[model samples]
Target: MRNNRPMSFPRQQARTRRFTIGVPRAFQISPDGRRVAFLRGRDGEDAAACLWIRDVDSGAEHVVADPRTVGAGEEDLPAEERARRERLRETGAGIVSYTVDDAFARAVFTLSGRLYAVDLDGGAAPWEVPAAVAPVVDPAISPRGTAAAYVSGGALHVVGLDGGGDRVLAEPEGPGTSWGLAEFIAAEEMSRFRGLWWAPDGSAVLAARVDDAPVARWTIADPASPEAAAQTVAYPAAGTPNAEVRLAVLDLDGDGVAEPRWIDWDREALPYLARAGWTGPAAGGPAGGAGSGARQDVVFTAQSRDQRTLRLFRADPRTCEVREVLAETDGTWVEIMPGVPAFTASGDLVWIGRGGDREGARRVLLVGGREAGPPEGAYLRGVADVDGERVLYSASPAGCPGDVELWLFDAHRGTSTPVRVPPPSPGGDAADGTGEDAGGVLSGRMRGGTLIVQRRDMDTDGVRTVVLRAADGGEPDGGTAAAAGGIESLAQVPDLPRPRVRFWSAGERGIPAALVLPSWYDADSGVRLPVLMDPYGGPHAQRVMRSRSAYLTSQWFADQGFAVLIADGRGTPGISVEWEQAVRGDLAEPVLEDQVAALHDAGKRFGFLDPDRVAVRGWSFGGYLAALAVLRRPEVFHAAVAGAPVTDWHLYDTHYTERYLGTPQQHADDYTRSSALESWGTVNRPLMLIHGLADDNVVFAHTQRLSSALLAAGRSHTVLPLSGITHMASEETTAENLLLLQVEFLHRSLGGAAGVQEAPKGAGGV
Candidate 1:
């Protein structure tokens, strides 16, 4: 219930800056809703993100050991020594952070390359699991919470909560080890990093093994020693032969050790393991009759290379046998499955697939029948329901942003009645012209004949707990009476405000954008605020309107009254692959033109936009775009911040860098034309460049090369080289300090009312 009046209020004087930036990142709530884990980060040249766990009921808290604190305790490291250590560590840092999201289990864990478990009760110290295991990441805990499974050294491993037995399940075969199963690479490329799954009885584990030995390897040099030599990196680009994938199950039969048995997925199948998980009991068969008198089921989806043809298999862990239950192929590439398929406790499979002949238009399907001919494109948007009797999904028919209707269909009954459910409007944009909305049951469970749905919104910004009757009739359980009103507006700003994302049209096609408004907004006053625009500008990618990220300080600056915009310019995902490849050849031209147009369009439509006070910022490839925007369209933005930006694509890796922009040798002119280094002479704005000396992603040379040219051109700018932070800095202390600098720089140039003093900085700011 919001005020409907559109009245305006008078201008007010500035107050103390009491705004929170960042989001409740890696947000996790224990299965029973008794505990939570999240990361609090800082803005600086090198970001420092720290982990914290809290009791959901009592609000008690404890700080997980920070990886940045490894080896050196607080106050122990002088600048130079710390830098040296950080550089060496960056070369191969394992899991420096772990987030727990165990809905089926109560106890949760956290690790900074080290395992530790915490009790769900009040204040408790995290018990460290003493082991130097290859950084256990992506812990997939069993529904019973007795054991957790994860990937290490390209093999699957499982650890118990009671301590003791911790052993590898799928060890690499013979001489040729897993091509590259290390951190960073696995987490970035393959969707699943710590790949491990639990059988229904929790007696076995299923995992994905990536054999990337056949891939081409290229070595990159340390930015500090660019001309010294090169270090090798095994990378496989699109169309190139990918790592052979295999599936195996670890039978942990009470002996506290995992027995590996490979499951036949047919290598010639050439299928990408898009989604896989242990199916629940029911659905009948041997899978439902594993050890411990418990029923166990396994399900996995494999999509072929061209992204067409999806094969779904149901496995019985007892016999290590896989039964191909469903398969679908399309003339055009079949739409990517809408995330992993949901398995009901009754063993009913639910998922979202496409057939409407257009992107963004998909249908909800309950995979009951075997023959799949263009899945039931009837019901629209959806979220996978792991255990729902009917296929429940979220849908809004082209004009509503967050007004999602929860539809339930009983394929058995052939009925498609939608259960009326209310959704928060992430933004009040009508669902017309490519505008997108997000909603779903955060996590729900059937307790005492009642269904509890935890609902949250990207629009209104908060989590609401609601209970519904099991029969969908009568008053909800506990006489709650449907919560007075289903929707409850939570705090947009907690200790750290969730990133505030909004959707607005910037260019032609009225494209959608995941924009963030400033934290300290004066909706009543009609004063245009400065803007910080970030455009991802890549393929199959999007900056969706969602909560803030741990690595971003967009809200912090917004807290200082500057609007931050992250628009998914034309070439980005969320639209179509056709739209994605449109700007492939054009390169920087399309992104730069669209964003600049957006600035003016935003200013004209929203009077609160200070068009002249806008600043552009990005990192990596995004940094390349940011540099281009300020250099090419200096009039659109007043300042620019590019961190570890790709000044020249020729120096980047072969896979992603060359995909859209051919080879540097083939398209020499395009490379030169699109590169920021070539246009450094035209960068007239107040540009601030930041890069980690040990960065291997875009490499420090990108900045080093550009800085030299800037100096030769006598263009004044600020350059800061972080000692050891890589492309993406995860340390909270460092990130916070970097954000503090961003705020100071933005405030100084944009003339915004500021509060906090500048954070301390180390050497190297030219």
Candidate 2:
């Protein structure tokens, strides 16, 4: 959420609203469709995460019992105690949230690596199922909703729905099961945290077992607690040994834990199982006719570390055998492409690929070398079949508006063919392309011989369940009216303005951003306005994608006539692993280059933008980016507002810092080049920095060093350390004041009409 908007913002046009804590997160629709489960957490110090379920139709809400019986974080404590706790939880609340309703809904939430289930019908408090010790994270229910599977305490597990029991099905063999190690290697390297999956019939679970026992663990003093003891976290820095990962399947039954069938791969090969799940049994059995026990094996992707090689492996659960049907490799890195389209009732596996010919080398590969596969002597981007024999898969590049494509693959022949799915009707900006925008999450199901694909269009802000009948075209399930309304309400957050996705090109990546234009904006009128470019430049930590920030802040920016931009540059998540890892050892270059490019691009494209009127801003890692953007590219930006930024990696906490930039001792040059404190003299742009004096994540020393270095370099900059403001703010006033100060900085430096604005009144928030 953008921090400051004037009263004229779009939200203000509707109504003035009271401040509220806790925006809903981890929203999960129940299997019965009668209820929606969500993780409800507080904001700032007043914030702590808790499980809460709501009646989808009635809007009734109930707080799921907390295992620690810690009532809503600060809400359960006294005033003085609340204030004290706020100080501790600001940097981060070590709380775990959940979403049940997958095939296995038995194990709902995870607490400190342990599994727990809450009654959907509202019975006793949450009960802990101690089958494992570590966090049973990212639990996936089977397609029939009988078993829930998760990665816990460095092992894969399955729990029965009818209160049968929980069992450890598979643990990384040999060196994979080291103590104090985080879960899978994919979760760390590829950043795919949910490391396991449930099959369609709940008969088997496909899991990614990562072995990182060889990687070294780094220690960092807890940033949230200076007087508190130091805490060590496992950090696999760049070029360091990463966890070796593999894919395995466990037999799921009411019987005891079945043996794990390892997918056949070279033992020396570090093959990453990026995606896995059963495609239901092969349609029509061996002869393409329906057969009860004739389900085809599950399909998974075996990728290499640099992400160069990809092999599609098909494994039969009954036989416990695996075979590589299709293989693709790249000298640089091959993108197996995450979030591929789902399969149809006809057993066609539609997915996106980047190599081959057909669409012409130039036309096929767009940003970051992405393109459709070779066509009839051509290529396709939206669809392709990795295992097709002749015409394995086809693609719809042009007609398919959204970034997602529809494909049909014949497993036996190993060929792919694209299916022409109708585009969303001409409405408010239809779903266009898969690139970085358009597609949110695609959920598909086969029913009554119809392959129904549920596409959530980020562009249209709508979700449609399209039904493709018998390989032929059919009407969408939700239809027009219901689909439109559901899409709107699903994204229509209460007391906030709808977010917009903005794009700009940086280096080889098409950097994407979410923008909230000022509510008072007049497009036709050439009114040069101030802008705030907020970014989070950490590796895989994308802040712009559907994130709920403090109290209607974007509305505040809109009201104030400041164009708020949240850019997910090269290193940000939601893109690819190569794009994310590229920032390693060169953190500031990719991010700084992108911010400058975006600022200039915005000015050139939008007539209302003031060429000289731009301010860069962010918090934590974002704050670090803001400091670097202005200092490194002072020509593009006028001012900067950095909140709790890590001025130098050498002095910051080791775990997170070293993970991206490596140890200061190992990559001394990169650490020095990426550090703002080392180049404080270049910070000639107008700078207004605010930080929590008690921030542990980014020690107050970061600000102190920046303040001192700027002074020594003879560079003038403003500094404000919010008293009692920990690294994070809980109360509304904290965010409000932050926005207020930020807007003031933008006004002074970006040529906001002098004397045109009055001082912001009232405390920042409640």
Q: Quantify all predictions' global Cα lDDT against the true fold.
A: 0.52, 0.51
Query: How does each model score on TM-score?
Result: 0.64, 0.61
Among all windows of 10 consecutive residues in model 1, the one with the lowest summed lDDT is: 8-17
Highest TM-score model number: 1
In model 1, the Cα lDDT at residue 218 comes to 53
What TM value does model 1 have? 0.64
Give candidate 1's error at residue 515 in angstroms: 8.5
Scored by Cα lDDT, where does model 1 land? 0.52
Candidate 2, residue 74: lDDT: 38
